[model samples]
Target: MARNKFQTLTEQMFYILLALQSPCCGVDCMERVRQMTQGRITLGPGTLYTLLASFEEAGLIAQTALEGRRRIYAMTPAGREMLQGEYARLKAMTADYAAYYREEEKQ
Candidate 1:
């Protein structure tokens, strides 16, 4: 059986979509991710471009502008819902882990 495409987003995909919350070109995406992650996440041009194409194809993101060779992307309604769902899932995971550790401490 095939897995769902949007089951989860990679770190790169998450940050890319996040950067797209505002209008920004490809180069701006790299900078934004760097600032947001404090240089922990480095986005290479190849990965960024590939993910952009895939996201656009999947209707997760739409091109809002084109400046020279750069394309500015933003989240679509679908993309926003996807992000929210992913955030919820992540939160649940952390909550569960924290609960387990708290229980362990009481023993």
Candidate 2:
């Protein structure tokens, strides 16, 4: 059986994809991730740029230069597909955990 490409995504990759779900520049992307995680998972500038570069290399995202020093990023078709897969996986995991907890409560 062929392995799924999305299985290679680490937590950082998932967060990066989630951040790019909205079209945003680098600074905005970082801030969005921070806000979304309620400041619990703030990414450093170096890590953010590295992840962006990797995403761009994988063709999951594309970068466009904005005015002056801004590079805006948006998800590609591949990125959207990856995000969808991740969402499904997370949904299933959450549902399974919920069921397990419910059963435990009944005990």
Candidate 3:
């Protein structure tokens, strides 16, 4: 099977999608990402906008509204599935690490 373009999301990509759990504009996405991460991750306007464009083009997200110049986006069904898959992948990875550490501690 062919791999999906978004099988694995970057830190920026993941946060951007997460920020759009509710409809949000570009600026809202940036600010929410920062807030959610407690300011650890900051997205520049260029990267965020570019990703938004690509994600929209790819059908991962859909534009829900245009409040003046701001374009608000929401995740499509496909996007939600992709995010869920990524979450599962992350869970598996962490579980493996936990198992490995537990065995090491037993030694």
Candidate 4:
């Protein structure tokens, strides 16, 4: 099924935040996300930039420095909080789904 756009705890956002948990340049962040997902989610430049922009605008992320042509990013407290909230929400959703499926299988 297609993913819902309203879902704030998205894989992309999660991975981005995860990548930023440590200092990372834009390209490194994208690579880290790709590696973490085992190539399942490859973020394009446009999408990555857009997400970064949104995160910065939301005060969740910040660009820390520039190494040559690369822009490094880091997670702020707000970003960490957001990530934690998303993780909790996802965990709850997974548990709910698991319980529902288990019951369904019993029938």
- List, residue by residue over 1-107, the lDDT tens digit for candidate 4: 11233247678889999999998988899999999999999999999999998888777888899899888899999789778888888899999999999999999
- 1-107 in candidate 2: lDDT tens per residue? 01154565777777888889778887888888888888877888899898888788778889865757888899888888888887888899999999999999999
lDDT tens digits, residue span 1-107, model 3: 11267768998999998898899899988999999999999999999989998888878899999999888899988788778888899999999999999999999
- Select the stronger candidate by TM-score from 1 and 3: 3
> All candidates' TM-scores?
0.94, 0.83, 0.95, 0.86
Clashes of 3: 0
lDDT of 1 by residue, 1-107 (tens): 01167679888888888888888888988999999999999999999999888888888889998888877898888888888888888999999999999999999
Steric clash pairs (candidate 1):
none
Task: Please give the lDDT score at residue 53 for candidate 1.
Answer: 87
lDDT of 1: 0.87
Top-down lDDT ranking: 3, 1, 4, 2
TM-score of 4: 0.86
Global CA lDDT computed for model 2 = 0.81
Alpha-carbon runs more than 4 Å astray in model 4: 1-7, 105-107
Instruction: After the best TM-score superposition of candidate 1, give how far the Cα of residue 37 lies from its true spot, in angstroms.
Output: 0.2
For all candidates in order, the CA lDDT equals 0.87, 0.81, 0.89, 0.85
